[model samples]
Target: MFTSILVPVDGSEHARKALSVACQLARQEGSTLHLLHIPEELSHETTLVWGIGAIAIEASREERENAGKQVISRAAEAAREQGVTEVETVIGQGDPARTILSEAKRRGVDAIVMGSRGLSDLQGFVVGSVSHKVSHTAECTVITVR
Candidate 1:
């Protein structure tokens, strides 16, 4: 029933599992797969205040972006191999849950497929989980691939 599926990846093994699941579903349903990677946010002023070395900070930022690109590329390749014709990649910054939800809304996705770390109810309620927050805030259906 899904037309467009959004999957959020954080370069973790769990996130990779979510990508695989999303690709398979998109293939089966002939849906578009949208893979999203959000880079950690850091501004120049904040970096300077934190006393981070300019060269080291720049390298770290570059590394994060490169990693994000790899994740997007891998997801795209998987979708293509599975015969999914429409695959999109997005990269943004900010809270993972908020970014994912906002992107899904912007794309008007039918469903979201993501990974969960299987936190206990208490821990999740206290510290919060991205999956939980996304499920609550998203306008569409949310599927957690734990």
Candidate 2:
């Protein structure tokens, strides 16, 4: 049985589903849920090209970190709403897969439940999905929710 579960979120619907599943499992197993959010950096050119019609960008590292914090807070709230009171939030920088794996190892989590797709699905296909990397590399069990 899992005693500690890690759930990485990126403000995506898939992540929300994964969080819901993780919450349910944690509640059933009396496990602690760890919610992780990694703030991504987008280049100016990329932002201009892809973010033209998007909402206003927060052009600062502190703003990005604050946004990440808000994301994790909402995720933790969702978990608590699911009746999982024991929740921890983590904000990490760098590669999503590596950060998640390191956090899992650091926290000694028994399992990881995350989304199959994130905010960078296209880039992930060209490179590799974080879920794919973590599933292959993590020492604990990985459940990728679609």
Candidate 3:
């Protein structure tokens, strides 16, 4: 029954699975698929904790954002292959959960389909998962794929 579905990707396997599921659902419902990639900012704590140097962390951020673009491109192609013709991709910046929620509201999406987990499993356990936060705070329906 959804007219528009938002799927956030982080290039994780879980996110890929969610993208596949969302594409199928969109095809079935004749809905548009909105693919969003949020490039998380590297925190000082993260660098220190992970033992990643500042220069390395800065380089990684750019690489990660580039990878995010590739992820969205692949996701859009997958959606099209699934017969969901209307697909849009966006690259967001900021906290993952807030970016996802804001995009959903801004786009007026009917539902959000996302992964149960992302690349930051340890961080998620410590600060709570993005999917968990979105599920609780989003105005629209949320489907978290495992």
Candidate 4:
């Protein structure tokens, strides 16, 4: 039984399901659930270089943070409802896959649970799935929920 589970939530339906599963496992094992949301990083230089309009850039940043907060908050609330008291919430800013794996390693978590589809449009067309990359690169176990 995993003792420390790290769940990365993105407020998506798929991710919420993963959170539900993680909560159940955590409760059954009497383990801790670490809920993580990787905030989208937006550098001013990148915005200018990409030729994104000022208004659009601001909107993107706001949307990213807003969505991230909602994701973490909802996951935390669900964990509480499932009787998981030992839950931690973390917000990261960077690439989703890399940040999730990094947070898992940093926390020395026993396992990682995340959604198959994240906040990216080209996720499916990538060389490797985010979950696959995390599973392969992480030192611990990774569970990907569809």
Q: What's the alpha carbon RMSD for model 4?
A: 6.7
User: Could you tell me how far off, in angstroms, the CA of residue 44 lies in candidate 4 after the best superposition?
Assistant: 20
Cα deviation of 9 in candidate 4 (Å)?
0.5
Residue by residue across 1-146, what tens digits does model 3's lDDT show?
99999999876778888988998888888898999988665432222111222223455777667666767787787778878899999999989999999999999999999999876777888899999999999999999999
Q: Which one is best on lDDT? A: 2
- For residues 86-146, could you state the per-residue lDDT of candidate 4 as single tens digits? 9999998787779988899899999998877654435445556667778779999888888
Error of 4 at 42 (Å): 11
In model 4, which residue pairs have backbone atoms overlapping below 3 Å? Answer: none
Q: Which ranking of candidates, highest TM-score first?
A: 2, 3, 4, 1
For residue 120, give model 1's deviation from the true position in Å: 15
Model 1, 41-133: lDDT tens digits are 332211111122222334587766765576567767766876788898888888778899889999999999998842123445677988989
Q: How close is candidate 1 to the true structure, as a TM-score?
A: 0.77
Which residue ranges in model 2 land beyond 4 Å of their true spot? 42-58
Backbone collision count in every prediction? 0, 0, 0, 0
TM-score each candidate: 0.77, 0.88, 0.86, 0.81
Q: What's the lDDT for candidate 4? A: 0.75
Candidate 1 weakest lDDT stretch, 10 residues: 45-54
lDDT tens per residue, model 2, 2-117: 99999998777788899999988998999999999997764321221111222134457886676667778878887888899899998888999999999999999999999998
